[model samples]
Target: MKKLSFTTPTAQKIYNDYFNRVSRCTRTLPEDDQREIMMEVNSHIYEATLAATPQTEVDILVDALESFGAPEVVLQALVADKKVKQATRTFNPRHVIQALYLNISNGVGFVLFGVIYLLIVAFGTLIVFKLIYPQHTGLFIREGHSFAFGFISELPGGLTELLGNWFIPVVAVLMVVFYFLNTLLFRLLKRK
Candidate 1:
């Protein structure tokens, strides 16, 4: 097996890419610790390159480095090392927003799960309430304000009561509409 070598350009590119990705992913490591981790990563890359076959040096180096662990893993380990001083890190807006995007992409499933959970809770609560104090439920509804504003002067009292009964369904329709709008906004922001 022939010894491999990385050109200056290739080494620099690999180092910079690794550093940027690592910095973006982690918030714990001090500057010296981060530098040490990067140095170790570059050493790995260099060693892997020297061991690579004739097919491709870059590919082999990348595969070897990845096999060891991702840059993020290295950063985590370095941060955990006792020699490194621990500091409270604030969340960067870019990181927070990226996390939000990831969550929102998977949010439809989460929302559905939440809806089912909420339905179960509501049903249980209603059953318990009825069993404990059946008369109170009707009294509570009767006393509650059905509408945000009693503006429909022409409507009969029976019609108002029916509208009040449909309040939950109306809110459900609004929530569905808002979900679509939020999805659209998320897509647009991601593109930017």
Candidate 2:
């Protein structure tokens, strides 16, 4: 069996690169802590490399660093660990409520807008049906209805009647309902 040694210069370069990469992703660590973590990781890599066969030292070193995970992953794990520690210290109801409010308001606003858009589509379709097939306009409603409310057909010239009588009011009412529901949702989210 043969032995492989990493020269002092090679080791220095490897250690410096590791530290630099780790430091780039860490925001809260002091210089001392950062240096200590870098040293620990470098030492682990070196030890693993020594145990590998002579021809496998380079591969082992690379594998060890990769197994330690990327710099971002390391920083995230450290941050999460710190959070777990701090989370046990206190709980703030206001902050939780604020986060919940923001999330719910944004979610509900999207749903309300989508519903209003669909309603406008439905109203437009009704107008088109009334104009193209006035007799069949009542088909949209269930059987047994005595009168078919074909606003578009009721117009003097057809086009104006559709826009003026039914389509406009239906669209307006839908918009009002959408705005009211959105406002109510916003208030409910904020209250939570």
Candidate 3:
């Protein structure tokens, strides 16, 4: 896209600095993605400047950038979205973690997803506990109603440990289910 020329040096500097900040925000993304984002921002600025009422170049540029908002704040969602797309495509844990961190503040859905992921990790760690403390690590049921999934410090008379040898498999299967459920939820969120 052709760069916009301003009547004053200050306006030009303002425009350049804005683009520089945008470039910084998008640097981690792929080149094509970066260019696409830059182009989109440039187009918005151009259109804003054109549609703006007659005014000083500095005033017009300032208004446009202000309305567009600080690049760091406004472009956060876009960067997070692109990161998520890349993460999903690559299926890399590092990328996925980055994507999640970027999107963590989006809403309750991301928060819930994060908590669910931590639970899955905790469940995975339970297998180690099962090995180290076999007696206290199984699914325990008290009064055949109250149940717990992890290590129990004390076994009361009413509490019975069930799924003795099957605890590891049960936790593993549960983790898989939770993982898929989170994936489904993440896809739904990405669509939004």
Tell me, by lDDT, which candidate is best: 3
Model 1 Cα RMSD, 1 decimal: 15.0
Q: Kindly list the per-residue Cα lDDT of model 2 for residues 48-91, writing each as its tens digit.
A: 66666665444566676677777777656554333322322232
Q: What local distance difference test score does each model get?
A: 0.47, 0.50, 0.89
Clashing pairs in 1: none
In candidate 3, which residue pairs get closer than 3 Å at backbone N, Cα or C atoms, i.e. clash? none
List per-candidate RMSD values in Å: 15.0, 14.2, 4.2
lDDT (tens digit, per residue) of candidate 3 on 67-130: 9999999999899999999877775767778888999889998888888888888998889989
| Residue 112 accuracy (lDDT) in model 1 | 49
Q: What is the Cα root-mean-square deviation between model 3 and the actual structure?
A: 4.2
lDDT tens readout by residue for model 1, 1-192? 122345666855765676577666444445665566656666766676667776555676567768767766655444433121231122233432333433443446434433543454454454444445443322222235553322232343433243334444544555556545544543443344
Q: What lDDT, from 0 to 1, does candidate 2 have?
A: 0.50
Point to the candidate with the largest TM-score: 3
> For all candidates, what are the clash counts?
0, 0, 0
Query: What range of 10 consecutive residues in model 2 has the weakest lDDT sum?
Result: 155-164
lDDT of 1 at 25: 49
